[model samples]
Target: MSELYDDFKSIVLNKTPLIDVRAPVEFKKGAFLNSVNLPIMNDEERHEVGICYKNRGNAKAIELGHSLVSGYIKEQRIQAWSDFIDANPDALLYCFRGGQRSKISQEWLAERGKEIVRLKGGYKAFRSYLLRELEESTLHFKPIILGGRTGSGKTIELKKMSNAIDLEGLANHRGSSFGQKITPQTSQINFENNLTYELIQKLHDGFEHLVLEDEGRHIGNVFMPESFISLMAEAPLVILETPIEHRIEITLNEYVIEAQKMYECAGFENVLEAWQESIQSAMNRIKRRLGNQKHSEVCNIFEDAVQEQKKNGSYDKYRDWVEYLLREYYDPMYDYQIQKRSEKIVFRGNASEVHEYIKSVTLFSGRLK
Candidate 1:
């Protein structure tokens, strides 16, 4: 009998390699941050097996699973697993509940003279542990929300500090309509996996305070973990300030110029047109909030900016629309939200000043030293 690993910290804190034996579809729905999917069954086989399990019984499902993965096909799968364990001497294998699939993989590997650890409760156990950890982090982490108007360099500042968790970075979003990157976002499960993994590591590292940008509940289509968001609302805030001209420059550089760069290398041409559509689409998300007249006006201003870029190939033309949206749309909404927060505003300063202040105040100070 092989040892089962139901211990949570033992698994997460260790660097031992893990082989995820869930189906590709299961892995795609959500997976650990460092895990690589080497599914025991692909989607179709898993689906048929699932139906058998539901309509018939465990014996029928097991028999059907065996039938689908026999002879050369079985050999191929085992060969892949053997190659992986060969490369990773200390690797562990896991299925959804650390059940039959992982055990079967172990038995086959043993036949091939390979012995590997089996994660006792598998992916489900690990996932439950992470959720518990995230909920606990709300209690452990002394969160400080870094508030700012658009283009305030909030994310940049967070990147410079060890204490901050860049939620926007994790979500691959900037928490705004124009914040979408050309790269596709992860599934919600993947997002939470990444976040919870980083979060618990930070908590374990003894960082007294965790800084994060002020984001609405959602980043793109993915939502922040509810517990973390609740903590953020009640926690203290430090707002960053930059001159309007500076903010406008940063916003255009990120949303327009850098966005153009992203889509260009994205292996897709007509990126300029894509950039325009992004701006228009982003504006559409706020149509109701911005009111009918303002929405139309903002879209028109945006169109005029793109036309200017077409004639002259200069992106500086976007400054007008960016400035308009910030002043007219985003700023008002931000103010309204801030007013509703129960936590006190702790400090307010520009990027340089706030970064310095954060360094001085945070427990992670001198960490780089």
Candidate 2:
């Protein structure tokens, strides 16, 4: 009767103001875009009412709840509603499930002759709509995966592209232990929601190419949705190549200075122990590959390289050690993955050249074909 469908869709598109009628804790956990929490029941009251419903019955709980909220409190709520109306005359309100709470709130507002719209199915309906839209949108826009070994600057190149979706950026992680960021990572659910939102924005914008960094299923604590992952594997790819020196420079620029400072500030004794434990098996393989004397030398070299990185302002010395690790560990794994992938190696050059080449290609062609 209130043009609920049209109003809800407009709000979903962020064309209308959203007012959430759930408690603060529920809102903190998650909420729809642009929605602000304005609770009808305070935390303690909600808990008490819920407990009464469980112990006594619904009728008694309702009676007790009404008794707890005095006439003065109701007047205060009306005043709050007046304030909200003054601020947002055409606001849309929703509760958890479009149940008694939202209906009551809507009726109360309407009694004051205020124009307000109630979400038909409330938060649950909004969540279901987002999930369905995400699923449907993935089928329409294909992704172009960017693959390379660690430190290849694939992520940086992806950012340079006019049309790109950064899963790692959305997750607030760089896809590895070494990929830590300044800000705390989002909850996995939030990450998925953000990714879905980004996908929708990109698809609706009518971008011909959607360039994304090559990532495994998980980026630290957050895992990409299976729909996006399957879409990634099925899409074409553009692989960039850079020399070991260039790769090491990029990796060191990203990780070493920050990691060193973090280690110094936090004390790396624990980190050193953890690092030793995590890479012990891999180090053993490296040790066996080289004879005892050379293995000893390699260990000294590795330690010296780390020490040098700590002392020198530059990261050039660490290149050899990182390259050795990549050759021994990361390269073989990447090679195996590349063999299985149906990717096109578009450009193979140093970091600068590769960036330039990608720019030219995308600018001239107007897409990554």
Indicate which candidate wins on TM-score: 1
Please write out the lDDT profile of model 1 over residues 23-63, one tens digit for every residue.
99888888876577887889999999999999998999999
As a whole number from 0 to 100, the lDDT of residue 159 in candidate 2 is 79
Q: Model 2 RMSD to the real structure? A: 6.2
- Judged by lDDT, which candidate is best? 1
* Model 2 lDDT per residue over 70-154, tens place: 5887667656766786898777878888876677777777778776777878878877767877788777765667778888888
RMSD of each: 2.5, 6.2
Q: Model 1, residue 134: what's the lDDT? A: 77
Tell me the number of clashing residue pairs for each predicted model.
1, 0
Which run of 10 residues does model 2 get worst, by summed lDDT? 272-281
TM-score of each: 0.91, 0.68
Candidate 1: where are CA atoms >4 Å away?
A: 1-3, 363-369
